[model samples]
Target: MYRKMVLIRRFEEMAGKQYMQASIGGFCHLYIGQEAVAVGIISALRPDDYVMGTYREHGQILAVGSDPKAIMAELFGRETGISRGKGGSMHLFDRERNFMGGDGIVGGGLPIATGVGLAIRYRGGDQVCVCFFGDGAVNEGAFHEALNMAALWKLPVIFVCENNLYGMGTQVTRASAVPDLNRRVSGYGMESAHVDGMDLLAIRALSDDVVAECRAGRGPWFIEAKTYRYRGHSMADPATYRTKDEVEEWRVRDPISIYEKQLLGAGLITDEEIRGISAEIDAVVDESVKFAEESPFPQADALYDHVYASGE
Candidate 1:
């Protein structure tokens, strides 16, 4: 869990740097402070389970076992990218891995995840579909509609909401009428709970239980992960809405640092081991950047190729 969390943190740090350097185009949302949410949830998932997420999905993709080199190449719009350079930061897909996509639309992934859950049941498979979205998305009609249908059908799906205090610029208190986002699926008659997103061990344990329940033909569940993002909603947003002190407060509970402290306190990892792991992750990130740099950008004619549907 510590290694997985660290890798995501370092990967996003490098991604942000690259975006500032003009290597990555399009809207880039850095999942800096919410490392544990992605690491914990994804690491607990089975290999064949389906996953879908919102625009802020880079970490989710990385944590789910996607190749860093290909992911970086996709961010760079290179032909060697996972989506063949067509989808940038907000859109990534890998059917082989069952990572459906990172939808750019706010609440778009909810219904799609429900459909995936339905499909799995239709095929008589026990695989669970995990849909990750932000606090802001739960208020959308699609979210309510999807959950209602999923609950009615008893679909094997889990709705994980990463509540990072604010939705873009508006705080949850100002945006949501309910405020307690854990109740998102309550009206739909689905089981739900709130979890400390910063605690990796707790998140992993709960996620494991959720997966098990869903795989056993139980109804859908919803999770309200109390997480926060250090960066703005997008690379463009300056995040002037929140105060400096508020940001610092959340920084102190940073998932990576908190997890590191736990590892140290438990005598599970030496200080030297932590440094070694950091160095290893840095090297991997450096290699990914190099791979993206050496890769070719898609040609203009290549655009026309994937544009039309081939009648199978």
Candidate 2:
């Protein structure tokens, strides 16, 4: 778990650097502080369980076991990318890992997740679909619609809201009529709960119980993970809306640091071991960048490919 979080942190840091260096084109959304939310929830799931995420999804994809090299290549617009360089940062997909993909539009993954749940039910499969989105998405009509249908059919889906206080520059309090997002689940008659996203263990424990229940047919649960993003919404934004003091306050409860403290307190790991893990992850991130740098770009002739399904 610690290694996974470190991998995401390191990967995002390198990705941000690449984006600024113009090696990675398009909008790049770094998943810096909200590592625990993705690591915790995805780690507790079965390998076959489906996972969907929003545009800010590098961490989510990584947590589901996607290759770091392929993800980095995708961000670099290389042919060896997971999406063959077409999807870029916001549209990462790994079908073989049951990582459906990341959607660019806010709340776009909601309805798709509902459909996945419906498919699972129709196929009489026990697999659950964990769909992740931000706080801003809850206000979208698609959110209500998707949840309503999922609740109605009792779909095996866990809708996780990564409530990171701000949806871009706008604060949740200003945008949401009810700041307590889990309470909004009352309308759909779905089960809901809140968890501290910085506490990876707590999130993992909650995920295990909820995923089991959902797979057992008492499903379509909602989880509001109270998390904070240390960086701006995207590479373009300066995040001038929030004060430096507020950011520092959240940093004190940094997910990686909090988890490290817990592990040390429990005598589960040593400082030396932590340093070793960090070194290993650093090497991995460095290699991913190298792989992306060496990989080829997609050819112009291939543009029409994968555009439509073949009749044969």
Candidate 3:
């Protein structure tokens, strides 16, 4: 878990650097501070279970076992990318891995995740679908509609709201009528939990138990993970809406640092082991960047390849 978080941290750092260097195009949202939420939730998911997330999803894709090389390649707009470079940063799909995609539209993934849950029920399978979205999406009508349907049908879907306190530059209090997002879920008669997204262990334990319950056909559970982002909504904005002191306060509870300290105190890991993991992640991230750099961009003639037919 430490290694995975470190890898994602370093990956985002490198991606941000590359974006600043003008090597990568398009909007890029970093998952720097919210690594624990993605890793912990994904760790609880089964291989056959589905995972869906919002635009801030590089870590989510990686957590669900998408190759770093492929993800980086996609960001680089290279043909060998997970979506053949067309999906860019927001959309990453791997059918074999059961990762639906990281939706670019706010609250877009909710209905799709509910559909996946419906499919599992229709097939008489126990597979669960985990929908990850930001607090911003809670205001979107789709979030409420999807939850209502998921609850009414008892579809196996776990809705995870990663509440980072802001939607782009707008604060949650300024946007949401009910800042307590879990309460919104309760209106639909869905079970919900408010959680510490920074604490990986807490998320893992709760998600594990909830996932088990959902897989057993008792679900459409909701979890509001109170977390924060270390960076702005995108690389473009300076994040002037929040203060340095606020950022520093959250930094003290940096997921990786908190977990590392816990691991050390519990005798679960030595300092040297932690350092070794960091070194290994650095190498992997380096290789991933190189792989993306060496890869080719999509061909011009391939634009119409994956286009859907009219089905007439």
- Pick by TM-score: which candidate is best? 2
Per-residue error (Å), model 1, residue 150: 0.4
Q: Give the whole-model CA lDDT for all candidates, comma-separated.
A: 0.90, 0.95, 0.92
Model 1: per-residue Cα lDDT over 1-312, one tens digit each: 787778888889999999999999989999999989988988888889999977998899988888889999999999999898999888988878899889998889999999999999999998999999998897899988999999999999999999998889999999888998655467789999789998998999999999899999995999989999999999999999999999999999989898899899999999999999999989999999999999999998886776658822
Best-to-worst ranking by TM-score: 2, 3, 1
What CA RMSD would you report for each candidate? 1.2, 1.0, 1.3
Provide backbone clash counts, one per model: 0, 0, 0
- 64-145, model 3: which lDDT tens digit per residue? 8889999999999999999999899999888889999989999999999999999999999998999999989988989888
Off by over 4 Å in 3: 309-312
Candidate 2 ranges beyond 4 A from true positions:
none
**In model 1, which runs have C-alpha deviations exceeding 4 angstroms?**
309-312
* lDDT comparison, 1 vs 3, better candidate: 3
True-vs-predicted CA distance for residue 143, candidate 2, Å: 0.4
lDDT score, candidate 3: 0.92
